[model samples]
Target: MGLALFELPAVSYEGNLKEITDQLVILVLDDGRTFNFKRSTNTKFFKNSKALKAAELKPGDRVALVAKLDDRAFLVASTVTFVEMTAERSAEIAAGVRRAQETADAASPVRGWDGPQLKRRALDEPGPIPDPRAGQSPSDDPLIAKAQDAALSFSEALPNFLCEERMQRFSRDSRMIGWKPLDTISAEVIYEDGRESYRNLKINDRPTNKKMEELSGSWSTGEFNTTLRNLFHPASAAVFQSAEYSRLLDLPARVYDFEVRQENSHWNIQVDFQKITPGYKGSVWIEPASGRVLRMEMQAVDLPPEFPMDQVETAVDYAFLPIGAAAVLLPVHAENLGCQRGTDYCNRNVIDFRNYRKYVSDSTVKFDP
Candidate 1:
């Protein structure tokens, strides 16, 4: 079922364990609202400071957990701690949740975008919460201008080049822990005149005549410039606001939150001959002073429950690489994750761009017959 966006502070949510499954745990708050949280191997479970397994969690148990909502609108638990369910303590927890809700509600009006804002907390450090820059337009924000200029120059600053794309496909059951390899796809990608085309498709080193996009699995294109256009192009009408300070590639970055309304979004999702353009929201990590984008994260939102897929999230990491005697900023690594609706399964694609070289039209090779 599609869920409404819920805003909460970066604090532990105290609740009673409502249900437990192999993949997730449901918690019922004092106000009777329930939350479904995805559990992972990294999710710490404890009772009275003693480590415990998820299976040990029982319904009606008083629990407090640190969780953040993901792009899918599902809460992902980082730490689940079971507490003693005393009459006085239960009342205290309920009051705490109420206060959190109030704080979130007051801040909601200033939150320009709908997405996760809390950076994962470290064991010894507190997490960074989003500091939304209220009452600012794209034209009035200096950070937004920097990003727009960089994005506008993205294609113009590049030279014609060729690269090898290596895609590793993986899948895992939602109830399971790790991803299993599905297949490896390789193709030659040509970027000329700000456009990209693929040729020489291969699967596991075996060449195929079929087009790269014709393959029978999750795939994506337009990582080169389309993403920048979608974010910075005037036609997109994307909204942006300051999110938080973060690090990318060990470099300090200023993260900005953004969203592209469905009506203006060019992002297309296809499922078994059906295609739909859904509204998307994500964060852009830009170099603080230069405004150069270091990374981008995007996720589809407000999907119909009847849609075959319920989740779509992607992350693209960029780096400067030498191509044609000049270094150019380009996508180095990307990850796309999609979850099927009504099923406990998801697919992930890890894409790498390598072997970059200048494209020379007159280049020729000779071989002995």
Candidate 2:
């Protein structure tokens, strides 16, 4: 067979502006993927069939962007067009407005990179250290008992509940500087009787097809819910190390970093962080007064020679979301990122729990209607 070549088509997503940070424009596309794009002077912007500015693009606006992977390996928008009706017209903007494009000469790039980067600010920076305690033990620390009690109380109080789960995975841009959207998974996660279940609801905003394995939640389920309930359970085998002070959700907290190592096996499901190092290392953040776990961070330690992954970092942020009429501390967001050694390859899972409801029943059935 003879090999023929064709121009690779560009990637684009149509969605509403979900968020605008220092350097990145996050779009929640109707297709389910939350596309992250870097805006540069070469990036064009428009509004109402006229050339506007990027700053003029607000959340909730209907827009379309024609983007291409840039030399830096980032998704850069070549043109951004806004669709809007005349102030009084009830009709949609004319089709011609979709062609408007303007060069943004004033937008500034925050990171040293030439464009917007996806590195989450809150996740990367471990904020300043609180109340230096270089050599202190939990024996005499009053906060320890209080925080421990809070964690236990929180776990014991955990009720059967359900929430909307949106998980997006990112893989390192093969030729770019950072990661790009690899797949988006939306599911419903429910926890009851110490058991968790995730129902794959949609993939890329489309119904799940059993034939497509990547869209299935089976691979990413089970890890977070159990880890949530067991991490601070006084009986866990993981050992705590340094105790320091930190803040989560803008509230004071006592942080305890710990490690969990495997005895003699390699990691099975996901990359085993403990295999390379002594164990998996992470920290727990507990609210000082009320004693509830607010946040947790974990990273694989001591990667071994020839290990497939170079680094692994994961974080989960907790908030008291409503379930029926009761409010309970639950995982609102969780992310897992695995980086390959000696390559730009990276894999990240971004999970969000929302729309919580009380667990009504555990029975489920499926059939063709």
Candidate 3:
């Protein structure tokens, strides 16, 4: 029912409050999952069905919190419902929470690439929105057109590649609690066939939280999903349009943001048999000098009423690096944020990509005469 790629289960987290800060709260659920919600002005708090302030919720209270990632990449409480810890039953549930180091697989890098897949719509056709880039340069510039053409065209066959990733998780909102280090882990991501897989490697010699691992993985992919190729691939069924110019890695980049609002769009998420039409919106930056995507950002909006989570936002950056003999633009970093639509909570992540290499085959076949 949850996003398998991000490792987020569709189920809610119910347990006793473990930690509460002015900016965030942590709940250790009956299962090993830890719920982190970022506090915001819009967050609603409830104590025994009576509305109250977030500061009123105490640690150890029996609580049920819905969660999503906030703008700061922190998962703060959105709406909290709790009953004061009456007896020591909270201790009972606390015992079930596993705080041991969670080692995600070190082999596969991505859970699997789901989208950034576009609708293959005809953006060049006349439409309600005039090409925003029309005034940037004369029709002869062809900066935007060529960039669009580059994104639309897949000329090279992409062989499998391997890269090292450093993922760090933080629990505190810098805007409030300053900085709180949560966990850090490293992994190897491999792109084989068409799907991306992740293999957890080193845990930085630090204990890893099972829940954080899932959150981090989800965050990593969510951010990378917005890259030009991933979103505008030939198989996509999404829409895009020219927008204002945007800066990417300090260079002037043309923008072609996109959105998906219809239920029929493949960008909509589904749980079990139900489709959660949480449409996606984001901007793509292309530097026409070489006609390559330099940056991308995506956010999920207009979620269905039944959706358990609220917000989803991701940002990714691409840099040209010498891969084999060519300087290819590839993902170098990404950030993902999610919130529970039930107005419960939020979570965030920052990922670093490095050490990329083309996959090499070691197998050889001998033919008999």
Clash count (model 3, backbone only)? 47
Tell me the tens digit of each residue's lDDT in model 1 across 1-369: 998976664446777897777678777656434566787677889988999988898898889889866666556788999887678976787677677656544542221223222222131123355556645675688878888888988888889888888899988774435788999988878888888988778888888999976788899898888887677888888988776766767667777788999778888776543356778998888886777788888888765444567678888888878986787888999888887764557788999988787877643222111
lDDT of each: 0.75, 0.60, 0.56
TM-score of each: 0.63, 0.55, 0.51
Order by TM-score, highest first: 1, 2, 3
Q: Which stretches of candidate 2 lie over 4 Å from their true place?
A: 1-134, 139-142, 149-155, 173-176, 209-219, 222-224, 233-244, 264-278, 304-306, 362-369
lDDT of 2 by residue, 115-169 (tens): 2222332452356465576456654556656656666565457677766777777
Candidate 3 per-residue lDDT, tens place, 36-116, comes to 556667767787678986677777777877665544555555677886564486665544432311222122323122312
Tell me how far the alpha carbon of residue 186 in candidate 2 is from the true structure, in angstroms, after superposition: 0.6
Model 3 C-alpha RMSD to native: 18.2
Please give the clash total of every predicted structure, in order: 0, 3, 47
In angstroms, the error of model 2 at 292 is: 1.4
Quote model 1's TM-score: 0.63
Misplaced by over 4 Å in model 3 are 1-149, 152-156, 172-175, 204-218, 222-230, 233-239, 268-277, 342-344, 361-369
Error of 1 at 143 (Å): 1.8
Poorest 10 consecutive residues by lDDT, candidate 3: 100-109
